[model samples]
Target: MSGLTVTLQFSGGAELLFDKVKKREVELPALEKFLPQINKTDWSLRELLVWIKDNLLRERPELFLQGDSVRPGILVLINDSDWELYGELDYKIHNGDTIMFISTLHGG
Candidate 1:
């Protein structure tokens, strides 16, 4: 199967959980990489969260993920638009899409 390329950005302290790397261009498999456990063919933010946790996340996963979704106070944007506006976790991922995660839990 082919791959879907997407841009991922982390900021507002979210990057700290990803080895402090703020930007990344990732190519995810077109088919569900986790089979049997996941029967879906398309990739969604919900699945991406698991993928990130298993692949991208370096440490302290609790800081980035709360259950199946991102921790509270973390803002997620897809293609520069709010993830909530795009069906949140159910949104289907497309090639060349940009996903950004920003933590709002930090103090000034």
Candidate 2:
């Protein structure tokens, strides 16, 4: 909480869990508490995945679009549906609104 100003939630590929935040300007130890071991707090959403070779099945982090390279596997829901369907990351957040990040299942 001391590191990040915004709130981050995890789900879909993971489970019902809340995140310890890390600020855009600052990196803190608390960041590792919520995310998977492969998830680098320093890397952006996209970069982290590629760094780990897209093995994001159970590995996910609460990511802001600015931080990393977001791709198809990562479904970022601002309120409900895709944030891109709404307005990409530019979509503003209101009080008490929840954002969800789900990994897209590829093979049917």
Q: Highest lDDT: which candidate? A: 1
Scored against the true structure, residue 91 in model 2 reaches a CA lDDT of 55
TM-score for all predictions?
0.93, 0.39
Write the residue-wise lDDT of candidate 1 on 1-108 in tens digits. Answer: 347889999999999999999999998865645643777788889988988998899999989899899999999999999999999999999989999999999766
Clashing pairs in 1: none
Window of ten residues with lowest summed lDDT in model 1: 29-38
What is each predicted model's overall lDDT from 0 to 1? Answer: 0.89, 0.42
List, residue by residue over 38-86, the lDDT tens digit for candidate 2.
4544423233233223322233334312244455566776557767776
Pairs of colliding residues, candidate 2: 3-23, 4-22, 4-23, 44-67, 44-68, 45-68, 46-68, 46-69
Question: Which portions of model 1 show Cα errors greater than 4 Å?
Answer: none
